[model samples]
Target: MAKMPVYLTTPIYYVNDRPHIGHAYTSLATDVLARFKRLDGHEVFFLTGTDEHGQKVEKAAKDAGEDPQAFTDRVSQAFRELTATMGFSNDDFIRTTEPRHKAACVALWQALAGKGEIYLGDYEGWYAVRDEAFYGPDELTERDGVKYAPSGAPVEWVREPSYFFRLSKWLPELLRRYDLPEGHPDRIDIQPESRRNEVRAFIQQGLKDFAERPEKLDLSVSRTSFTWGVKVPGDEAHVMYVWLDALTNYITAAGYPDTAHPRWRFWPADVHFVGKDIVRFHTIYWPAFLMAAGLPVPRRVFAHGWWTNEGQKISKSLGNVIDPVALVEEFGLDPVRYFLLREVPFGNDGDFSRKALVHRLNGELADALGNLANRTLSLIQRNCEGRLPAEAVRDASDAALFASLDTLLATVRNQLDQQQFHLALESVFASVRDANGYITQQAPWALKKTDLVRMAAVLRHLHTALRAYATVLQPFMPATMAALLDQLGVPADARDFGALATPLPEGTPLPPPAPLFRKLDLPA
Candidate 1:
């Protein structure tokens, strides 16, 4: 049988800066969805990459005594390396400067221009090079004799010839899509209820028609102030705006210019995972661009909140940025991955602290889950001569514990579909806690002395429960789950979602038990 296709994407990271925890958070969220869908038997295309071209890169290169492309290559490679260091399974990494991407961007621009949705124009506004965004007079603040954006990036006055998209023409259609019934094919969902309302509110604020002075609302589609981007199709006098170039990365990766290419079949991406700060870009501008080009706006745009270090916003100036590399090195990748997803709800802001991470690692992972695996394997080895029981001999207590796990696969599947990562993990931990309590109360050791058959049954139940827990946790904590499965004598081939429902073969010889999540000793 053919599997369904699921296309997932993360916002391309801007190489104007180094990758940080916020970048990791977005990739981690997308990676979880990709892994879950693949395990669920879907053919998945997961894309993540770098937005490497901009005036920022050119100036940064000039400052650093390097060419613009060379500087971008260095920073983009750093972003790619972060994916491997953070243990992500992204299928492809793209750069805006890539030749294929340049062709794709030019193709998209020509299509929109051909449709009469774009026109050459002039723009004058307060621009933030760092943000690559324009602001109105009221939008800038005078900070100690300098005008700055709300985000603190410095703004400069610019008047230049440019290209503008006919954004307002489709405003009514965009608004109506939001009002569609849930799951309607044409409905484009903006997730986390609050963000959907936020985007709608921003749209209602005001949209400048092309007939108007063309100031506050019409987006400048091509920037004449900068040439470090994809060139406009016939008029190479200006470059396509950086955001447009960056956004086209999604279609470019899906083989846009070659519309009939196999990868395009995964279009109308199932979801686009983005940070809350950029919700407006994903929900508004990107969708408008796609609709104008006659492409599908992604099915859903989910914007997740940021992380702060102990109540203060993470910033390079603050010197308080969480080093993803250090976090994984200090604590193993699985524990770090588990902490990021489990510490907070999927869409809310989270605060990271050393104390909190160590607590989750030692208390929940080491004590609860890892302990379950170690104790279960140890019991079977010592009591059953290193061979699993022929079959699980069930009692009311054993059956009850197993029953808690009966709905787990379905529950996690639902949670992933909704992108509720924390809840999905929380549900898995519920069974882990249940198994812990069952083992303590059943007293398998006491049964060993009093009733040999009952003792074997109790150990078997514990073993089965641990295997189930490991199976569902694979998407979140890949390394830890693989280690747990190895200790349980489960073969690599039998460690998939389908195999989770099958019982372990009787008398399977297990390797000696080892701790899957060793207790961490983080300094206070």
Candidate 2:
């Protein structure tokens, strides 16, 4: 059978700090989708890595008295390790500092130049190195006696000789493309209705390609200033702008600008998952760049909201940033993963709290799903000789469970396709809740004493139900699901969705059972 090609990516993390809950959330979501697609027999290509070159890294390196390349190497390794620790199965990790990445960046720049999209120009504008973006006067706000970007990054005025892309020239084209349907190749995530109106308003006020000098602009190919980034193709004096250089990492990871490369099928990324803070850059500038280079724009750019700690924005400077590794270690990996995806609705802002985490682990995991597994397995061990029993026929309660499973599976696939991860998880929990209720009503334990045949039928139904649940959850809680399947004596890889009713033999000896979850202890 020919499989569908599926490509997924997380915004490469900036190597300024170690991974956090925000990073973990995004990567975990991508991993779930990747695993699900692969199980469904898709030709999956998943890519993730560090954004190694930026002004922040340059300054951090200077402060530490190390070359930028060496500094980035250490930081990038830390980001790479996150995939393994979190159980990610990424196929490629491309750092912007790689020679191949540099080549792709240079090639993309030349491609744009060949199309007369780039030109030499001097720029004098407000540059926010922290955000790696230039802001016009209108976008700046005065706060606490300092100018800041809308996302609160500090800004500074600068005048420099640089090459410029004719961004203004593409405005009409961008708007036209943005109006296309959701999955169009030319449709990049353009500005939102309000934001698009704002951009149009700015253009109506008279757009200017160069903020300071237009007539006597001294634009050149190279600059002698930085050795940390990709050099301009013909002139080594200038390096590509960080924004220009950073965006190319998306395709560079897929072996872009090289059609013959083995991993090239993953180009035209299926989705770009980014935080809301960088929506404008990803949605506007990135698509424009691709269009200029005559490359296909990505299918979608889904911008999710940010997380605040205890109702306030998380910041290391303020000492409120939550450590994801600490949370995972303290309350197991699946609990943290489940809480983050379930607590927040995708694409909306949310707050994180220790109290909420404990509530979810205890209320949902320990009390609901964990108890469901314990009761089902415990009954099987006592009545069915610690072995699976064959089911002859399903009764009313069993029929209800089967019906619910059908709904759950359908809804889960729907939610995931829409990037509504939390909604998908809710469907899983709904099945858990329903199955638990069905077990309670059927009373398999009670039937074993009087009617052995009825008890066998009930055990068979429970085993089939639990097996289906575990299969559905394999992409989300892989470790726990594997443990559950191990107790059932089924191999991990054999638990894919369609194999739900394949049935264990009539008398298969079960492995030792273990608690699927430990309840979190709430502090006084």
Candidate 3:
């Protein structure tokens, strides 16, 4: 049977700054989903990259006394290094500065123009360089005679010859496509019920009002002030707006403008993972662009929340930015990965603290899961001659435990499909805690001499249960789980979701156990 195709993406991080925790969070979430799909027998195409063209990058380059291309190349490499540093498995890394990406953007612009969805015009409005977006008068807040965007970024009035996308023309069609009742098959799914309602309300109210207001303006899709972006197809003086170029990266990575590209089969991404701050762009503007170009919008846009640093907003001025690489170096990679998704619900804001991270590492990873695997494998090595226990009849307790393992894959599948990562990890650990309790209650150590046969039966059951846990956890903690599976005497080929149905052969030789995670000491 042909494998099903699954495409996933993380919003390209801007190249004006170094990679930060916020960037890592979204990419990590997307990586987890991509890894899970692959393990479940799907052919997945996962993409991530840098957005190197924008007014911000140009200004940042001038400030540093370097050419824009040189500056972007330096910073974009930092982001690319992050993928390797954090163990991301993205199949491709795209850059707006790349030739292929430029071609795709040009192709998209020509298509929209051919459809009469874009036209040359003079743009006069309040624009925010920090956001690379235009704001209407109503959307700006004034304080002390200065104007700021809804995002709190200060704005400036600008007038230039630009190309405008006929966004107002598509407002009704966008509403019809995205404003439907939840669960409609054709609706553009924007996740986290709160965000879904937010997008829906914006389309029904905010966009409607913006379109019908006296100006009756369309969206500005080109900029003449900065020479840092892709140029409009036939207009050399005007560069395509940074957002337009940035958003086209999704299809570009999937081989856009060349539908015959084998990878093009993964078009219409399964999901796009973006930070909450940019949900408006991904859910609204990107869809409108694709619709105007007659291309399919992504199936879903999941906007995840931000992380605070020790209960304070993460900011450069505050100097509280959390560096993901530093965290991974201090704590092992998998433990850091585990704490991130486990510490909070997927779509809600979270606080990152050294105290919280340490507690989860010492308490959850070392105590709950690591200890369970350590003790179970240790007992099997010492008592069962470093091999899986021989076949033994099961009791009611063993039957109940196996039943839970039987349904675990389906349970995790459902949770992940909804992108409930925290819930999925919770379900996995629930079984881990149960296994811990079972080990304590069964007292296989005590039964070693009195009832050797029953002890073997108990050990066999636990061995099977541990395999199930490791298989599902491979996506979240790939390295640690791979090591765990290696120690279980499981074959390399027998580790995917499909292999969960087959138990390890009885009396298979198993290697001696090693502790997977060490308990961390609280800082003095």
Off by over 4 Å in 1: 207-216
Candidate 1 lDDT over 100-188, as tens digits, reads 99999999998999999888889988999888888767668996899999778999999999999887877768889987999899998
lDDT of 2 by residue, 344-408 (tens): 98877899988998999898888888888888888878877788888567666578777878666
Q: In model 2, where do residues sit more than 4 Å from their true spots?
A: 183-185, 189-227
- The lDDT per prediction is 0.88, 0.78, 0.89
**Residue pairs in clash, model 1:** none
Candidate whose TM-score is highest: 3
Worst 10 residues of 1 by lDDT: 207-216
Strongest candidate by lDDT: 3
Model 2 Cα shift for residue 234 (angstroms): 1.1
In terms of lDDT, model 3 sits at 0.89
TM-score of each: 0.97, 0.92, 0.97
